[model samples]
Target chain A: MKKIALGLLQVAGLTVFSLLVNTLTSLLHIPLPGSIIGMILLFLLLESGVIRLNWVEVGASWLLAELLLFFIPSAIGVMKYSKLLEADGLQVLAVVLVGTFAVMAGSGVLTGAIYRIKERRSS
Target chain B: MITGLLFLGLTIAVYLLAKRIYASSGKMYTSPLIITPLLIIAFLLMTGSSYESYNAGGKWLSDLLQPATIAFAIPLHKNFKVLKKHAAEIAAGVLSGTVIAVISSMLLAKWLHLSGDLATSLVPRSVTTPIAMSISQSIGGVPSITAVFVILTGVLGTMMGPSVLRLFRIDNEIARGVSLGTAAHGTGTSKAFELSSLTGTISSIAMILTALFSIGLAPALIAVFLH
Candidate 1:
């Protein structure tokens, strides 16, 4: 029970921190999203030792573990745009399929080549 | 209020069940990520329920994505050592991947003669949903459409990423992670974790850096291609 309580408290802290960062982003008219900025700030806080890993680990891990749950609704939002999908679904599908494949292949091959070069130089 | 609660309950029930099925099956096609959304989509369609009603409850869940994005810092911090050693390789891979993604998306959308909004939306589809949605909105594309594209890209990546990596002879874990994360974003990261934790960690970093680069580069790249 105590562990659960601490976990919830930690998550609450994270939520508050995320909100504050978001508020600042809007106020400053930063082009980036609040979440991105918040993430960077949180990382810096952890690295600088201002925030301990244990402080956020449980809640962060839980959230990360269930990350897909958060995205489902938004993806379901595509149902609302049936008109667009029906009109250009084939074209859209083609672009995404080809684009994703290109990125995966391109990044994978390049990184492999570089990794081999770096390993050879070091050895 | 009851309707909203009902939809939320329904979504959670389906998601839990989907997770269970995926766990038992251990197949990419059976993944909770794909099954949950597809099941929910089918349910909504069969019931003739409007997206707004479903989203009335669904939005509460989706709202957490921002916080979830912030939660990524933990893994990043935990894996600092590995990240440092492979920093040069990871950075180069992510940067090149971003450039290739943007250029290919633009050229494909143009060659296919998609509208300006659609071409714009396609540009950020390589990143995570939250980042892609915002980037789409900022650049005058439909955020919702961009979200779909992002999710589809992720699903495709999760399903086919291994084959793509194998075909490219990418045996290095870092290379494999970078490919999945840079191309497929969050879903790819999920798939990466299934392969190995180290790959997952690298994928997480790749996903974050990909988002940052896409945010910085997408607007300008879109401007050049579209205008």
Candidate 2:
């Protein structure tokens, strides 16, 4: 009972932090996601030693461990509009797939190039 | 109501099977994100279960994504030292990559004759959902459509990014992480985490940076190119 209560408390703490940041972002119109804002806030707290890692580590780890699972439902949210997408789906996929490759390729090559330049200059 | 609970149970059962297959096969070709969703989709097809019914359970689980995203900061915090070391280079790389992505998507939309709204929506699909949605709405695009495109881009990028990077011989964790996150956002970050914890942390930072940059860039882009 104590274990469950402690776990719930930790999760509640993290959730409260997340909601607080979410609210702030909306109020401020920050153009960034509330979750990312929440993340930055957590990072600041950790950095300042205001919030120890152990305080939220367990809850955070559990959430991250199954992060992909949470995305599935949202991903599959595609199916709700399956009919409208049926004709244009291939076109859409083509654009998206090509775009993905371009993005990855561009980022990877640029980062690698920068790394090499930095390495060569240092050496 | 029972459908929601039953659907959730079914998902867990299917996930285990998918996990076993993924492990046994050495995680080649199929990802849990891809394969498990395919299985559930197929099951829905066979069972004639509506997406809304499945979403009844799915939505509750998906709610966890908000906190999960916030929790991503833990990894970023742990890797702050390395982040500080390479901050400038990381920024340059992510900045160029996002520009390249936005440009390529715009060019592609033109070449394909995508409608005005569609083109506007597709431009920010490289970023994660929230940022992409915000950008889409601000630019006179359908946020829902942008979400679909963003999710699809992420799934495809995570599925093929590693091999594609291998073609360029870009094997460094920093490169991989930054590229994956910049290109595919959260989905790619999950794949990066699969590669290494350090890489995942870097990906989180890269993902956040790319979203922030795209926010500023999206307006100028549409004004200059689309108009």
Model 2 DockQ reads 0.73
Give the interface RMSD values of the models in order: 1.3, 1.3
lDDT of each: 0.87, 0.83
User: Candidate 2 at B24: error in angstroms?
Assistant: 2.3
Query: To one decimal, what is the Cα RMSD in angstroms of model 2 from the true structure?
Result: 2.0
Task: Summarize candidate 2's per-residue lDDT along B129-199 as a digit string, tens digits.
Answer: 88889889998889998998888888888878878878878788888888889999998998888889988
lDDT, model 2, position B115: 76
Q: Write the per-residue lDDT of candidate 1 for residues A18-60, one digit (tens) a residue.
A: 9999999999998777888998899999999999999999888
Model 2 chain B lDDT-worst window of ten = B22-31
